[model samples]
Target: MAARLPALRHRDFRALWIGSACSSISLWTLLLGNAWIVYKLSDSSLWVGVSTFASMSPYLVAPLGGMVADRAERRILVRVTRLATFGVTITLTLLALANVIEVWMVVSLAFVQGIIRSVEIPSDQALLANVVPISDLGNAVALTSTTQHGSRAAGPLLAGPLLATIGVEGAYGISALFALLAFASVRRVSVSSRGGVTRLRDVGENMREGMVYIGRTPEVAAIFILVFAHCSLTMSFDAMLPGFAETRLHSPSGGFTIMTFGVGVGALVGTFVLAMTTGARRGPLLLGTALASGISPMLMAGSHHVPHAAVGAILMGSSQAMFMALSAVLLQEVVPDHIRGRVMSLYLMSAGGVMAFMNLGFGAMADRTGAPILFFLPGAAFVVITLASIATGPYLRRIYRTGTAVAVAPAA
Candidate 1:
C-alpha cells in the first residue's frame, strides 16, 4: 500500500487521486440511490433497465469523448464536468425533496450525468497517464484501479444504511457534497499539455487509426472482444439482483444494495492483491483471472442463499478487478502514447455500452423466465468463454511478442 502511494508523491497525482476517489464514491452512491428510486417509482423491471440505459448511453460517444480529451485541456474539462454533475445532482435532490420527483425526471437527469461522464472518462484517463512517469505507468494505473474498486466497495456499504435512514433525497444531497469536494480536488492539479496540437480532422483520423490498429493487432482485438462478450453475458448480474432479492433470497429491497456491496468487497480485495504483487508477471495470469471473473457471476446467479450469492459476488468482484487492472496495464504498455486515448476509449465503449445493453437484456430475462435462469444461462456462457480464452492464451502471447519486436526494430 505504501508503495502504491508513490504516485501520490507527485503532488498532482495525489490531488487527482483524491478528487477521483471522492467522485467515484459519490457516483456509486448516486447509482444505488437512483436505481432504488426508479425501482420504487415504476415498480417494473423494465423501468430499471431503461433507467440504467439512460445513465450509460453516453458511452456510445466514447470515441468522440476521447477525441475531446486528446484535443482539449483535460483539467478544465474535468472541472467543468464536476461542476455540471454538482448542478444536476442538486436539481435532482430538490425535486426529490419536494415530492415532485418523477421517473422521467430521474431518467433525464441521468442522461445529462452520463453525457458529462463520457467526456470525463477519457480526460481523466489521459490526465492520469500524463501525471505519472512511463516506467511507473503500470503501477499508477493499477493503483487507480485499486482506488476505484476500494471506493466501489465502500460507497454502497455506506450508502445502504444512509438510504434507509434519510431516503433518496438525502442520498442525493450527500452525493452532491462529495462532487463538490471532487471539484475542489481537481482545481488543485496543474495541467500540462502532452499531445501536440489537436485538429478537427485528427479526431476522426485518430479514432480510425485506433480501430485499424486494434484490428491489425489480434491480441488487442481479442482483449476487447473478450471484455465485450463478458459484459454482454455476465456483467448484468446487478440489474437482475432486485428480483433475486425479492423472490429467491426472500429479502427486502435493501438486499439488492447489500449484494452489490458484496461484489464491491470482493473487488477491494482483488485490487489489494494486485497492488501488493505489482511486479508479478501478469500476462498468462491475467488471462486466467479474466476467465475466472467471467465464471464467478454464474456462481452467484446459481446461489441458493444470500450468503452463497455474496460469496459469488466476492469472487466475481475480485477477479473482475484484477482482470481489468491488468488488462489496462497491458494495453497501455503495448499501445503508443499518441493513440492511447482512442484505444482506451474503445475499451471503455466495449465495457460500458455492451454492459449496459446486457443489463437491460438480463433484467428483461429475469422479469420473464425468472432471475435464477438469468444466472444459470449467463454463468454457463461465461465459463465457456473463459475456457476458450485460456485455450488461445499461447497464441495471443506470441502475437503480442511479435508485435512488440516489430515495433522496436530499428529503421533499415
Candidate 2:
C-alpha cells in the first residue's frame, strides 16, 4: 500500500487538518454540554431538538456564504468565522459563570454560531482543495473524517468530567480556548485566489450557475440527493439520542457519553479503512454503508441492553462517516475550482438546512410516537432510499462499472 495518509506530507494541509480537528472537538464539546444542560433543565426531548435546530437553521443562508467563499479569500473567511465562534463561546462562558444562563440564551447563541458556521463549513471545505494536490484529495478528506470522528470521541468524554468538576462555565471556557487556537492556526494557511475581486453582482450570477450546474449534471445531482436523504433520515436522530440514553438505556450522562464514544471509535475505524483503499468502488461502498447505517439504527431501536445500543451507534457512525467523506472527495474532485465554494455551500445546505427542519419534526415525533419509533421508521426508510437510489441513480451505476470517478468534466 502506498502510504495510508499521503496528504500529511503537505505541511499546509497538515496544519489545516490539525486545526480543524481541534475546532471540531471544541464544537462537539459545546454541543454535548449544551444538550445535557437542556435535558437537565427542561427534562424535555423537544428542547434538545430545538437546540440542534437553532444551531443548524442558519444554513438557510449558506448560499450567500458560499458566494462569499467563492469570491473572498478562503483563509481570511475561515479566520473571521473562527473569531466569531470564539466571541460566542467566550460570551456563553461568561453567562454561565454569572449563573444566569438560560435556555433562550443557549438557543440564541447557537443561532449566531450557526450563522458563522454557514460561512465556515463551505469555506473550510473549499480551502482544503487549495492545500493539497488533486491526487491526495481523497486521503485528505478521509483523514478529515477521522479527525472529526476522533474528536466526537474526545469531546463527550471530556464534557462529562468538565461538567462534573469545573461546571458548564468551565466547559464553555475550554471551548473558547480551542476556538481561539483554531483561529490562530488558520492564520498560517495561505491560499491563492482564482476568482479575483468578485463584484456583488457576481453573487446572484454565481448562485444561479451553481444551481444550473447541479441541475444539468446527473452524477452531481445524485450526490446531493443521497446527502440530503442521509441527513434528513439518519442524522436527525442524533438530536433525540439524549432522551434515548436516559429513558431507554436507563443510564445517566455517563452512558450517553459511552454510546457516543462507541460511535466515534467506529467512525474512526471506517475512515481509516477507506483511507487505505486503492481500488474501492465508490458506488457499492456508499450504498452498502448507507444500508448499514440504516440497519444499525434499527438495531438500536430494538435493543433493551446498553451494549447493543452502543454497538448500533458504532455501526451507524462508521457507515455515516464513510458516506460523508467519500461524497466530499468526489464533489471536490469533480467541481470547477471557480465555483467550488458555491457548490460546497449547497452541499452544506442540504445537510444543515434539511436536518435543521427535520430535527424539529423528529423531536415532535419522538414526543408523540416515542424515540424508538422515530429510529425504526427512519432507519427503515433510509435502507429503502439507498436501495432505490442504486436502482435509479445513474451516478451509482457508473461507480459500480468503474472502481471510481475521481474526475468527471465540470458542469456547464
Question: Tell me, what's the RMSD of every candidate?
Answer: 2.9, 1.8
Clashing residue pairs in candidate 1, if any? none
Summarize candidate 2's per-residue lDDT along 123-152 as a digit string, tens digits: 888888889998898788778878876677
Residue runs of model 1 more than 4 Å from their true location after superposition: 194-197, 201-203, 393-412
Q: Per-residue lDDT for 51-114 in model 1, tens only?
A: 7887787887888877777777888888998988899888989998899999999889888988
**Residue 408, candidate 2: how far off, in angstroms?**
3.7
As a TM-score, model 2 comes out at: 0.95
| Candidate-wise lDDT, in order | 0.75, 0.81
TM-scores of all predicted structures: 0.92, 0.95
Candidate 1 has its poorest 10 consecutive residues by lDDT at: 403-412
Name the top lDDT candidate.
2
* Stretches of candidate 2 exceeding 4 Å from the true structure: 194-197, 406-412
